[model samples]
Target: MKKRNQYSAEFKAKVVLEVLREEATVNEIASKYGIHPVMVNRWKQEFVDRASEVFKKGPSEAEKALEKEQQHVAELERKVGQLTYEVDWLKKKSDEILNRKRP
Candidate 1:
């Protein structure tokens, strides 16, 4: 099976912008870019949809919330790792003390 081609955001934007320019047909653009017309159309639609956010005053509420959630998850992961190390160290120390007492 052949893997699908992946274009970078910048390249997608460039192609989408060309389509929006009305100078060339979508088929022409797709053929030039070596991509499918359907893919080109999809990129153009995404470009149009996201274009509004570019003019918005600030980050959207959802974006801010998502960033906050990611940070919180990272902090929790750090704490979990620290606690796991501490628990492992305590178990080892306790086993050492128990062995000493047996002798």
Candidate 2:
């Protein structure tokens, strides 16, 4: 049985970057790296797809800050609900004690 090849993230990134340069053909790059041509082509396409996102301003600093703030609000809301439940329980016990003293 032939052993399957395993590649690290760094190695895949390097291969994708090399292909993005467009200076070398996929076949040539594959030959130099001893990887399959189809694998090199797939990496090249993936790099192209992700490279566009880097240039776009979709995930800006403001968006990240807003996300953090929303998460904090959610946590605070949960705490408030827990405290409210506890207060209601205590109020019910207090009412019961006062009624017993009257009787």
Model 2 per-residue lDDT tens digits across residues 1-103 = 9999998879999998888787898899999999999998887777777776678767777788999999999999999999999999999999999999995
C-alpha displacement of 93 in model 2, angstroms? 28
Model 1 residue runs over 4 Å out of place are 81-103
Q: Positional deviation of 81 in candidate 1, in angstroms?
A: 6.8
Off by over 4 Å in 2: 52-103
Q: What are the clash counts of all predictions, listed in order?
A: 0, 0
lDDT for position 75 in model 2:
100
Give lDDT: candidate 2, residue 91: 100
The superposed Cα distance between candidate 2 and the true structure at residue 15, in angstroms, equals 1.2
Q: Rate residue 88 of model 2 by lDDT.
A: 100
Q: List the residue pairs that clash in candidate 2.
A: none
Clashing residue pairs in candidate 1 (N, C-alpha, C atoms within 3 angstroms)? none
